[model samples]
Target: MTHRFVFPTLALALLLAGCTSLPAIDPAALPATPAAFKETDPRWTAIAPAEAQPRGEWWKAFADARLAELVERAGRDNASVQVAAARLAQARALLRDAQASQSPQIGLNAGALRQAEPGAGGRGATLVSAGAALSYEVDLFGRLSRASEAASLDARSREALLQSTRLLVQADVAQTYLALRAIDTERAIVGDTVEAYRNTLRLTERRVQAGDIAELDAARARSDLASTEAEAFALERQRAQLEHALAVLVGEPASGFSVAVAADTPPLPQVPAGVPSTVLARRPDVAAAMSQLQAARARVGVAQAAWFPNLSLTATGGVASPEVSDLFKWSARTWGIGALMSLPLLDGGRREAGVQSARADFDAALASYREQVLVAFKDVEDELAALRLLEDQSQAQARAVDSAARATALSASRYRNGLVSQLELLDAQRSELRNRRQAVQVKAAQQQATVGLIRALGGGWS
Candidate 1:
């Protein structure tokens, strides 16, 4: 009767081991790419190559040595990039650990003890035993395989995320540098305007004393001078703030770092355009999201494998005797091997709940991946439209600045020759200032938009 029961139990274990269920998944079942790109302008319709560039040196296109150096430093020292890199290393270590589990684990056992008898004639003996034991779980249902797959995908995802963080840091440094340059330009303009206004105020006061102009003109000149001074103060404040921000972005104390402005404006780099669909593969975030989705899908397989039986084989061998010399004798040899199996006959629906939970997580991952793709497309389109409009506006602003300069020159000549009132000269002066300020603003906008385009294109970083 005992043999019959043993045979039935073995048969049940074998039957349960073959009961694993894995769902089928096809990569082709993923959603189609959305039609989000619009027709490009004829002048800007040419697409650039989408080949990856050297890692973390993408700012060389600007031809600014200082900017390049700053980017290099930030990439190496930035806290956020360091954190991402650490996470990537951790994920790789975890993958190694998971892969190691596929093989058998062996360990050594050794111990020695001494005890004295309770009688007056005390005696002690040293006990020394050494052996190696091994335990290995049979992955008959591919549970270990699926788990390793998930771990590898997670490692790849972390690597992609690190790349994404590096790109962001590089872009930020470049944008902040451009902003600092723009503020410096504005400061110069404001300084010259203030000087001109002060001269105008002094001349107006002289003309009033000479009875050539009314006191009202002097008051207006003073007001204009005051306004220009106020603008200069504001620009100074802005420059200081930008300086502080740039210092922090580069991982330095704000007070210890300062940026020197070049006399020439920084030229915008040429951005290569690509198809919207290509961005899905090039953007690090998008790639990371897809990897995460793959990992979650693999986890579904892992969860399903849990519903079947688990098989483990263990073996232990050692020599034991009351005397140390007798331990190696033939009579002291002892060894045993056994196979263990566990099947979930009834769990009050816990195994089913695990399957459902895994499915829900898989569904959420898919949704997140889709959303990332959509947002990536949207970002590219928005940058495209912005670049187009800003280019046109910049040209128009250049023409307006020219026209205002000519008008200012003519009005000043008329005032010197007594052909026009000082009020007319003042109006032209105000108009010229407004036009120049607007021109500076337009230039800044163009540079900023170009930077945005580079970022949207993943900034030539891989």
Candidate 2:
């Protein structure tokens, strides 16, 4: 009679002990966000959090068809994006496995045995049994629940990382394609300069033959033509390298892939700036970090719950008989049900170590999350500042190019009229070419900075 009461009393004790709740996590421990970014534009307006929203066709804002196509191709085929997607799939599968642990496990069992009875000497008997068993953990200390939550958060983190990878690939494709276009513009400028030098060389050679100018002037003109041609070749090499990089981004063989030289680079698109909080919420890296932190927090609870008693309920039903004919009889039926409560009395400090390790992971994840937020803010500020300064630089470069062009035209006419020497005409020509190339370079910087701003802002303002 005393033994009959033991199981119920033990179960009651375990249930009461499980009433101990996990400690609450403080949200205030995270870094505080300001209402606006330090460099937020006044024209910027409040927008909804866009992390969950699709950044559909953000590259189209540049109004370049080829760029949009390349970005879309990179999004579909980039190796980094594919790897992140595979990781996300694995995380989801692990989440399903964790959820399965919370559900009852059912299994079928069957066995056949042949054994000799000691009293029967040489006689052998056959026993056959078939059964179904059900087992379930009671989750008395919320360990299973917390484990599932952690798995779910891990899946979310992987998903956010995948989005971040896609965004990165898109930005890379746009920047590379824009760079190639800029090289094309510079190449055109150099090609024109080379032709102009060739013309100057021919005029100098004719004047030298007629005894109007010395051989020295023709030698200088020849040197200028060769150097300008060499510069054009350098631009060609850079354009080829950029094309190869773009091909790799789109998952194509570099040897066979090429982007046609475009006559014009795309105009820089205006990217709006919103509050820092909204930008943080929209960035996938920040989302991934937050998920990691939450997952770590859940794991901490799971580790703490490990110190509590675990309760499991099990049931089995089967039929057993000495003969096959008797196996189906009602008298051969057998059924059993049991409840178990287990608590570790000694573990050589393993439980305490697990709790400590989990807490440490939580702390590390918290730090990582904070760092990611700070970096995200820094990226936005850096790009904003770059675009602002690059715009002013581009305008100033344009003025310089115009002034150089006028000086070169005047010097060329004076040289033809014998009012200026060949060296003066060559100097003005060199100045014009340098200023024009600089203008193209500044324009390219502006385009790249625009793309950087879009990427830093988490894809698009929309």
Candidate 3:
């Protein structure tokens, strides 16, 4: 009994001695964290906000409850977000599979059989056998460990992707809703302008009938009326299209969805610009890129592990006998254990190729991560410039609208007092109408710029 147990123990010790753990890898070599961007351009220094709220409901800065509600709905129901979530689940399952490879596996077997002999009369010889077997491959060179690490990094990357997609969907929903509101405002303005032109045309016709104004003046007034009416029709079509787009963004059928148009426009939201380095942590795309780099680095370890030997231990126990009734007797009991070592002595440079491929992939991932960082910085810079310039433009447009209003008032008063021709009044009115429409456009652009800045800053992912 002592001898029987001693050999099994010695074999087990040798098996353990043959197995080795993976070498540690340095984390710093993967990729350097991005630094804060410093802009020497006067525009960035002048317009950059001193502080920012990088958290939930960034749209609430506009103080529009409707807009906030729409953003929330889209974040919850958007198909793109659903797809990202599914991909994340798949990555996690893959990670689980990789981790499972690190442990031993055990299974059970049980069966019964009968036998016949040629030299004797055939007889029923029932045989019953039952046993359990275990098999395990020791990761002596860290292959399994590196594979698990890669899988974990892949899961992290997927999670970051999901977050990024959610932010984009939220931004899209808000922008589309804002567009629909802008169209509604334009439609109302055009409708009012069309009515004013109609009244002018009626007055001009009466003057022509009274022989105070030429038929030519009446014809010009009628032409202006038709043009304004056409503009109104075009604006209506644009408004419908914008509404349909918003409906689709919120994952609703376009036919049954329509955004309610309020008489008041939502104020532009205030955006605070934080430090540039904050984007690295806040932006999901940046995080995903970094995770990808980590996964690639792990792949290098996985490839290097192939240069070492693989160790496996297998054990089996069962009972056998010529007669089925004697199968369970101690005389028929048997057991065996074995260990295997497989070293790649030569493979026609296949292992070398694997190592080279993994290194190349790592290099590519490093470059991609760097590019993503540069692009993120560019997005923030562009948005900063746009917001600053658009603010000045909106102010200038406001002044133009005011001046045009004054000109229209003067022209209308002069015409009523018989101090100016009806033609001059019509021209003034058209200018004021155009200026007002342009002002609305400028305001919408300012709102959009604010939205862009928020999105570029990763929609407050931090």
Candidate 4:
């Protein structure tokens, strides 16, 4: 008995000694990061990235009640977000399945067999057997543990992706709603311009009837009025389309959903004055990529473990008897215990191929993680640059709108007193309308850029 135990214990010691540690990527080898962002504003303060934390209702900072409501609805009902949530759940379940492999398995079975007794000259006998079996595979090489770790990381990646989806949906809804509101304000401006053109046409017609102006002046005035009306109609068409798009974003049918026309657009949300360059790490997409890279690294360990032998311990106990009534008797009791060790000597290079495949997957994941980090930095820079440039452009456009409005007023007074031609008056009116429309568009762009920056910063700076 002592010799039997000694051999098994010696074999177990050898297997334990051969266990390998999982491979890990060296942090020093990863892509270098900047200490500060090029576009960092003076008002920004340095803070660490906290992408794993909950991002509350960031849209409320805009102070737009309708926009806040719409964002909430999209978070709850958006199809993409729902799909991501389902995938996260699946990944978690897979992690549990992988973990189950590390635990012993138990099974109970019962059966009745009818056969002839070999030495009894074809005498028939009935045998009843019941048994309980337990088996456990020792994780001597860490294969099962690495597999579980990979599955856990996969679940983490899915969870981050779900957060990314929710943020995307919220930002999209806010931008679309704001765009629709800008269109409403623009339409109102065009409507006012159309009325002004009509009044100009009426004045020109009166002068022509009195022989104070040429008939060509009256025709020119009429043409200007018609052109302004066409512009107003075009704005109406654009507004309709924007409204339809907003309806779909809020998870409503285009035919059944509508937003009330409002001349007021949502105010731009304020950006934190001092944002740290490390904020890029808070991006959900980047986090997902990092998780995927870790998972791939763990799978490499699992593949490398395939070259080691697997040891399983099994035990069974039960009773068997030819008579059903005697199956459970102590005299008929039977039991067995065994151990198995499988080591494949030749497999046509299948294990090597598995290791190579796992290594390649790790390389791909590493590259993807690096790319995601770069993209996060790029997104923040793009929106920051857009906001800065658009602010200057909007201010310049505002000055142009004011000057054009004054010019239109002066030209109209001069045309009435015969100091200016109808052509000059029409030119001034067109300039005013164009500048006003451009101002509205610039304002919309600024608001959209604010939304983009918020999204790029992982939903909100806080």
Candidate 5:
């Protein structure tokens, strides 16, 4: 308001900007990182260069066109993915709002007010004013700068979270579809066994009529056929439930969607497990956590900046006249310029509390980031172990299935030739069916684990 005060204000502003500073954020502040995974056995190796990005289409590795189509549809139509996308858009808007504070704000203003003159004979006069005003807050203490930085990092975190959500949805669809196919394979096996047992039962009845075998033998054959038929029906029910779940995942009504019964299990792809650090970095969840940590650190700087004085520069240029007709005349013009300095002399403990809260948030984000890193490595290792052991289990189950089939054939011949009892033949047949079903189940597990490994590695081999 006065020239005498202007020089002192300018000198004080220079001193505050020079003396005030916030703590810098360093990535090294985090806990120590692991160089490699704990279970990097000889069987597993680093991913290839081509696998690093790989277009992020891991489902294509199974070579299932239908699966690729379904995944693509889910990305486009799933409600959860859409919600995440909307959140990203909102974050971007908030970042823009924070950044806007750095720019000069210009606005138009117009108003009319009637006032009664005091100590007068109740006389009133109308005053009309109209103008454009400009204002800007000079970020001498870096408060606005830090706030903008925090908003920018928050938007990045939202983007990474969106990617994580999409990866989760895609993986879920693949595993559910694989499960449906596996049930189909088991159902086909049961269907064939039931038909074969029916033929055997008819032959047993003919032998009983000729007095070659007792009635008990015919009854045993009949019982085996009925049990196998019941299992096939159970498989059908399971398939219906899985199909319904799959439809919901794709954001479709269950009554309108169906997967045709497939007699073959889908192919299992070999997902590579890279070094632990590299794999963790590629994961979207880890990236999101790291971004949130950086955002928190920026907020801490913002809170510290709040303790320092704030400086702002403002300007106004407009017209003012009592009569509307003279509003635009040069004689009615008015303009002013100002510098405002705001300092919180005393506010109890609000500023200190804010600084502490910001620091606490930063610590929480840092912990979350470290936990995500640990979990990422664990997921990759778990899937790797499952795939390795399931491989061995599948091979052993295949051998059992083959042996069971051979035993059932020999026992059937022995019974027809009066060399073995009907009960022994039934035992061999049931054992063969059980072994076959177990083998199929093992293969299904291997397929599902393969998908899990791919997702853990962040979409592709790497």
Candidate 6:
């Protein structure tokens, strides 16, 4: 009896000794990050990245009541966000299923059978049966544990991806709506210029009738008015297109949805840029990448476990009788118990291939995780650069608009006093309109860049 237990005990010890745990993944293994941003404005304060935390109501910082309302609506109604939520739910369910495998399974079964008895001259007899069965895998090699860990990690990955999707949709809504407002502002400018040109045409026509101005002056005024009106129409068309895009983003049909023409761009928010490496912790996409890498590592452990042994226990208890009423009799009681141990002694290299494949998958996940971190840094840098350069452009454009406005006023006065030709006055008017439009466009760009920076910083500064 002692010898009989000795062999199994020695085998168990060998199996335990041979088992391998998953490799540890370190965030520090990724490429080193820069301490400070290369292109940052003096207005932005840089602090070391803090512990990762949830983002706040960052959009509300812009102080636009309408934009705040629209962002809330988009978060609640966006189709892409709904899809991501569904996927996250599915991953959670799958993780639960993996966890259930760790527990013993019990089932009840019932059956009736008719068969000929060999010793009873081929007489047919009906037998009735009922039973309770139990089964459980003894996870001796950690296969089930690793599988459950991988599933749990996968669920976490999905959760992070859902966060990423929500951030993307909200940012897109902000940028699109801001662009529409900029178009409205431009349309208003053109409409005002068109009215001024129309009045100039009427004045020129009256002067021509009184023999005080040439007919060519009236023709030039009419031409300018018509051109300005055309520009206003084009701006209106662009506004319509942007409104349609906003409708789709909010999960509504464009035909049934509308946003009133917004004439004012919201003041840009002053979002500070945190330490450059902090993006790895701040961005949900980066978190998802790391989660996937961890899951892949768990899968590698599961694949390695396949080379070891598996143990299982099963039991059944039942009663059978020719008559249904006798099924529960004391004399009809039956029971059984069993233990099974299986170890793969030989295979056509299938297990080895599985192990190799799992390792390769892990390697791929690691590389992808590294790439995601790099891309996150690039996103922040791109937005920072855009905001910085656009600010400089906006300041210069303001000066240009001021100069153009002064020139247009002086030219108009000169034309009325017969100091300049109609062509020269019209040219001044066109220059003023162009400069003002450019200024508004630059302001709109600065606003768009601010939103982009907020998004690139993972929706908020820490």
**Which candidate leads the pack in lDDT?**
4
lDDT for model 3, please: 0.77
Model 3 clash pairs?
126-324
Which tens-of-lDDT digit does each residue in 299-381 have in candidate 1? Answer: 88888877767779999888766678877888877777988877767999987898899888888888888787668667767
* TM-score on alpha carbons, each prediction: 0.86, 0.89, 0.82, 0.88, 0.86, 0.87
Where is the poorest 10-residue window by lDDT in model 4?
41-50
Each prediction's total of clashing residue pairs, residues at least 3 apart in sequence or on different chains, is: 0, 0, 1, 6, 0, 0
lDDT by residue for model 3 over 1-462, one digit each (tens)? 966965665565456445633233344543343334353132232222112224477777777888888888888777888899999999999999999999998988878777675566885566677778889999866789899999999998998888789888888877777877887788778877887788788888888899998999789878888998898788788878878877777788989987787756788866544543444346778778878888998988888777766779999898866667787889989788988776666899998899889888887888788788668778877777777788888889889889988998999899999999876787677678788888888888888777776777777523
Residue 461 lDDT (model 4): 67
State which candidate, 2 or 5, has the greater lDDT. Answer: 2
RMSD of 6: 3.8
lDDT of model 4 at position 94: 98
Worst 10 residues of 1 by lDDT: 42-51
Which candidate would rank higher by TM-score, 2 or 6? Answer: 2
Q: What's model 5's lDDT at 310?
A: 78
- TM-score of model 4 vs. true structure: 0.88
lDDT of 4 by residue, 106-218 (tens): 99989899999899999988989999999999998788999999999999999999989999999999888889899898988888778767777877788889899899988
Q: How do the candidates rank by TM-score, highest first? A: 2, 4, 6, 5, 1, 3
Note the residue pairs that clash in candidate 6: none
Off by over 4 Å in 3: 1-54, 112-128, 208-223, 273-280, 318-332, 346-348, 412-418, 421-426
lDDT of 2 by residue, 307-416 (tens): 77788999999999988888889999999999887878799999899989999998889889878877877887788788888878988998999999899999989989
lDDT of 6 by residue, 244-335 (tens): 99998888999998988767777877755443444435678888888899899999989988877777899999998999999999888889
